[model samples]
Target: MKYLLQGFTMGLAYVAPIGLQNLFVINTALVQKRSRAVITAMIVIFFDITLALACFLGVGAIMEKSKILELGILLVGSIIVIYIGYGLIRSKGVMEKTADVNIPLKKVITTACVVTWFNPQAIIDGSMMLGAFRASLLPEEGVNFIIGVMSASATWFLGLTLFLSIFKSKFTDNILTWINRVCGVVIVLYGIKLLYSFIEIVKGY
Candidate 1:
């Protein structure tokens, strides 16, 4: 129970940040239908849990040990995150309506995977955070801890979707555009942080 509560709080703090996953999920909820939004959130949750489990298990430990691997991921991920942010900021045609966007379910699935699975910063951070926690716990508490993490993911994403759906009437096109712009700026800042981490790592070598 101690581990369970700890995991839940840590997971919430980790997932609450406005990173790529949150941006994608929020965008989906804003422009997509309620049903589609729920589906997208669910898909994101699935990939998120998968990544979290991998980090908790051992994948993160591998990265922690491999300086070269960590450096490569940090550099590449920083560049990609910055590029996405730039694109989001400068794009004139924000996805204003579901009718205009109409992203396919298959595409959504692929994107969910990409945003969660292939995200370098997420992988590194999750490993650093969850992996450390895993090491500190009693071996038998692993299940409880991970279950707490999974529950937090479900709660946050689903709650976000529902919140957006209920008040979606208030998000006009202009407001949505500004929200995207702000999110883009935040993402770019996050990328710069990752780049700084990469530099700090290289300095140690």
Candidate 2:
């Protein structure tokens, strides 16, 4: 029970904050292609959960084998985060609005998979935080930890979908720009946090 609660809390912490993907989904929802956006969001969540499971099971042994391995992971993760943050900050453009648009489900899924899975920070975040945290619990508590992570993602998706649906009519390019800018700031903050952790690791070495 305790482990489950902890898992849920940790999941909330990791997923609740505004990030690049969150902004992407939110903007997608505001557009006429809500279905496509929702599908993309689901794809991201699916990959996140799968990676979480892999990290939970696969990385524990590596961590135990060598402290350097763990530090290296963190360093690499921090660099990726910083690079992503820079991209977001420098990004300047608009998503072209289209009417009578048709996007294939397969294409949407593929794009989302690339965006989510290719992100090194996402992998590290899941492996180091969600994966390791869940493994710390007893066998019976596994369900709860998984539940927590799933719940966090589900809640975000549902809430974002609802919000976009409600305000879809009011959303405009300007609103999207604002959302993107704010999300950019949040992403930069995440990058800074990651960099700080890397510095700590370096100092320890």
Among all candidates shown, the one with the greatest TM-score: 1
Q: Which portions of model 1 miss their true places by more than 4 Å?
A: 59-101, 169-205
User: What TM-score, over all chains together, does every model reach?
Assistant: 0.64, 0.59
Instruction: Write model 1 residue lDDT over 1-205, tens digit each, in one string.
Output: 8778756865765575556787788788877789999999999999999999988888435655776765776677677657656765764434334332258889889989998999987887677556545533456676788888899899989998899888976645575456556656765665676678678768878
lDDT of 2 by residue, 4-63 (tens): 665565565456445556655665676646666667677767866676667666775565
- Positional deviation of residue 57's Cα in model 1 after best superposition, in angstroms: 0.3
User: Lowest-lDDT window of 10 residues in candidate 2?
Assistant: 93-102
Q: What is the C-alpha lDDT of each candidate?
A: 0.73, 0.60
Candidate 2 runs further than 4 Å off: 61-102, 168-205
For candidate 1, give the lDDT of residue 33: 84
TM-score of 1: 0.64
